[model samples]
Target: MAPNLSQAIERIDAAHSEDPTKVDIDGEPTPYELIYAKKMSKFLELHTPNPDPLLATAARAQHFRRWEVPRDSYPRTKPGYFAWRTFLKKRQADQVRQLCLDCNYSEAEADKVAALVAKEDLKKGEGKGDADAQIIEDVACLVFLDDQFDEFEKGHDEEKIIGILQKTWVKMGKRGQDLALQMDLSDRAKELVGKALAG
Candidate 1:
């Protein structure tokens, strides 16, 4: 990573460190958002090792200080869920953009990062803007499947789980789908994934 981007990532990481919500990682206490960001970054690296600095910044800061936006604060309806998600994407992009600008990156560079974080124009297989954005989405899906799906499965019913699996599968690329299928998921979860894909 470039020096400026390294500095900006430090800034973002520091902000996430302040989150009050905590999660245990191998018996170590870690801030929830920090772990999430790290997972996103790791997934991005595994998905594509040579991502540009802007994409890397977007991945590492995609959930910057995300605990500030508690899910319960929004209504429990579908529209409310969508609204909160949109708010998070925009907020994350804006925060990362400021960090990039503060670290002396050009406005265009920062804007590209913002666009990637917001996932403004992602497509299947174009270069740069479109493909980079899709990679980020693929990383997110991979992280969710690997890290959060068990917890998420607790609240939703079978039908809902199937729907979510389908939605997540659609967001991912071929590599991510293959990786997910190869995960050591519980039998039930694997069955649901298989069902979703079989459809």
Candidate 2:
């Protein structure tokens, strides 16, 4: 017989009960910690057609880490900040790419997955101002390039796409620099100012 919802929930609870590390202000263990501890069991229980546990876990961890690192502590200089974000983004993209591969996605589909990652607004609905908007736009442009490259590979219109991408890159570069200047960056990050200015 198929398991009932209560039975499934009980199993999840039991798996979590086996280990408890991190906790919230009220002393409740975080779901992520629980998921990490009981990944295998939880994977089996929560198996669905749409989502995979491993991918979900990786994404969740990335999201958690992003917020955990205080923005003030981030690299202040332009190059430093760019390098830091580049490193973080590459790691995140690698994980997503692996997930796509495991899910049997084609190369084109995998590229789309990477593009989506670059375009995603990690800080959506946060009520921030123009700086946030600029970051989002710049990141989206990066994603757009990835997608455009994929289109080029498929023999689609190239000249028009290149022109559009060039224009977008110029606009995003300017906006990124403006946003970067408004914040206090580290000396290392400052080096990225020139690159951002030229972008």
Best by lDDT: 1
Span of 10 residues, lowest total lDDT, candidate 2: 55-64
- Candidate 1 stretches with Cα past 4 Å from truth are 1-3, 124-129
How far in Å is the alpha carbon of 17 misplaced in model 2?
Answer: 15
lDDT of each: 0.85, 0.42
**What TM-score does candidate 2 reach?**
0.31
lDDT (Cα, tens digit) per residue for candidate 1, span 1-199: 2338789889989998999988888999899889888988887887888777888888988777778899988999999999999999899889888889999888898998999888888764443447778888888888888788888989999888999999888777788887777778877788889888887
Candidate number of the best TM-score: 1
TM-score (C-alpha, index-matched) for candidate 1? 0.90
